[model samples]
Target: MPEEVIFESESDRSREEIAAYLRTVADNLESGEGITLKSDGDSLSLDPPTHSTFEVKAEREGPEGGPKELSVEFELEWPEDGETESESGELEIE
Candidate 1:
């Protein structure tokens, strides 16, 4: 499937700032609310269904033994036309 970019923004931020943003999203999700993103007059709203796929990934990019970049990504995916979620093993983080 072709991927489409809706709204995106990236910038340097403190750990507390990042955590606050994540907490806001988590709160809305728990209360069954849609997420609305607004930046520079561009806005996007996303309302994920109850049953969706959640993915957590930890990755290291860049050349080996050189300057490396590490990242952790959290994603939620669900079918727009039809509902489907794949199963996976349990994930634990320390």
Candidate 2:
């Protein structure tokens, strides 16, 4: 299947700043409200179903003997029609 990005942002930010963004997302999810993303001239609002598949990944990219890049990503996925089913799994983050 092909994938399209509705909204995206990349930048350097302080830990505190990153926490703020994450908190906003968490709040919206908890409230069962639409999440809105806005940039200079781009904006989108999306509603996530009550339950969805959540994925977390930690990865490293770079050639051997070269500087390595590291990243952690969090994702939530659901159908466009706002329906979702979850697989069995347990996760914990520190």
Candidate 3:
């Protein structure tokens, strides 16, 4: 199955900023480089970072009866310096 990636930000930054940042991150991912950014209400999440991510809630028929919802969390870890690394909270998916 193809992996889906999505990005969401807290109710702080503007939509334009979030979109720009996501675009940059996507570019970096395409180049096989790790990206690190300080939390500013902006975040990104991906299923595999190779396919695509949707902002809308996705639903599927459950095997038993009801509907099933699939949610995922993603973290970004970037190398800072020699033996030093930085980590950030999971990107908001909602």
Instruction: Give the winner by lDDT.
Output: 2
Error of 1 at 68 (Å): 0.4
lDDT of all predictions, in order shown? 0.86, 0.92, 0.51
Which parts of model 1 are misplaced by more than 4 Å? 85-89
Kindly list the per-residue Cα lDDT of model 3 for residues 1-94, writing each as its tens digit.
5544444444556879768977987788888665664456765443233333323334454567766756433444322232322334354555
What TM-score would candidate 2 get against the native?
0.93
Lowest summed lDDT window (length 10), candidate 1: 80-89
Q: Report the C-alpha displacement of residue 44, candidate 1, in angstroms.
A: 0.4
Provide TM-scores for the models. Answer: 0.86, 0.93, 0.33
List ranges where model 2 is wrong by over 4 Å: none
Ranking by TM-score: 2, 1, 3
Query: Which candidate gets the maximum TM-score versus the true structure?
Result: 2
Pairs that clash in candidate 2? none
Give the true-structure RMSD of model 2.
1.1
